[model samples]
Target: MVIEYSGIVVRSVLTDKREKFYDSKGIGCYMFRIDEAEVVDATMHGSAARFINHSCEPNCYSRVIHVEGHKRIVIFALRRILRGEELTYDYKFPIEEPAAKLPCNCGARRCRRFLN
Candidate 1:
């Protein structure tokens, strides 16, 4: 499906793992792994797929929904987002291992002291 606003059109995928690859512009892509309240054959392992990245204070948040009988992650805006703003969410919530933490370079004024 396509999520459009202004002239920007983002392609959303309904594949397993909610995989997001870098676009031609180097921006992370967005997709919906579930459709019509049904979860795709996606099982989100604690890999890069779970690392949506973080912000000092993010403008979006991730919500897990149990559709049909599977779990899927959905990102929603926390406030009114401007047209050119980069969408980000807290990745720490999904990672359970200490090794999952990495250095963040988001450059937010209140960025976490460390990338964990």
Candidate 2:
């Protein structure tokens, strides 16, 4: 028997290409840190996964999968998402200073005003 799943689809990557635009604007954020000098920036070649917005109270979350010395970001649903609902997840980036906070428009009831 063949089974089919229909909700949100995720993709994977295995490269490190810097985004000068984000770096220049200082608005870009790292998806995951692989090492002291390297980070996984989904915007480099992201798919639908990149488009997923951030929510303080996200319905989805990401998990890192290490395989053959490479790190991949996998997103999983935290609950049964209904059709037409926007897929969102927390960026989970650390915030050390007020100057580092970015603006957020997620529209979540618990929106923190800034994306940390």
Candidate 3:
């Protein structure tokens, strides 16, 4: 079945010169990496999309869309999702240091032991 995603846009906390930002406990999930030094926090905007969880094998994927010269992150379904299924997407946070490794509880068939 086809599913349309929608949410609010909010400014993200700026991380300097970093390609990725991950928060284990924060509401923020996906960061719109504008460039090497700029990122727009899509989660800070009070959107329900921020609550969407992460999975190694996700049924949805985040795509970057540009509107009015601003970059926005949007989630799109990859396959049919039955009703009551939890919406999920891959965080895809960059794995740079060992400390960046986070345990996964997604329970997908292809669980990547740790989330980057």
Show pairs that collide, candidate 2: none
Overall lDDT per candidate, in order of appearance: 0.49, 0.62, 0.65
Ranking by TM-score: 3, 2, 1
Give candidate 1's error at residue 79 in angstroms.
0.4
RMSD to the hidden true structure, all candidates: 9.6, 7.2, 5.1
- Residue by residue across 1-94, what tens digits does model 3's lDDT show? 2222333333334452222434544433544454454465545543566667889998899877667996656678899888999988888877
Write the number of the candidate with greater lDDT, choosing between 1 and 3. 3
lDDT tens digits by residue: candidate 1, 1-116: 11111111122333322333334346444333333444322222222333345686788776666569745556678888889777777655333367666667778888875555
The TM-score between candidate 1 and the true structure equals 0.48
* Tens digits of lDDT, candidate 2, 11-116: 3233222345566777553345544544555544444566777898898887766659765567788988889988888886668598777888888888888887
Top model number, lDDT: 3
The alpha-carbon lDDT assigned to residue 108 of candidate 1 equals 86
Q: Rank the candidates by lDDT, best first.
A: 3, 2, 1
Candidate 3's displacement at residue 37, Å, is: 3.8
Q: Candidate 1: where are CA atoms >4 Å away? A: 1-53, 93-101
lDDT of residue 79 for candidate 1: 86
TM-score, model 3 to reference: 0.68
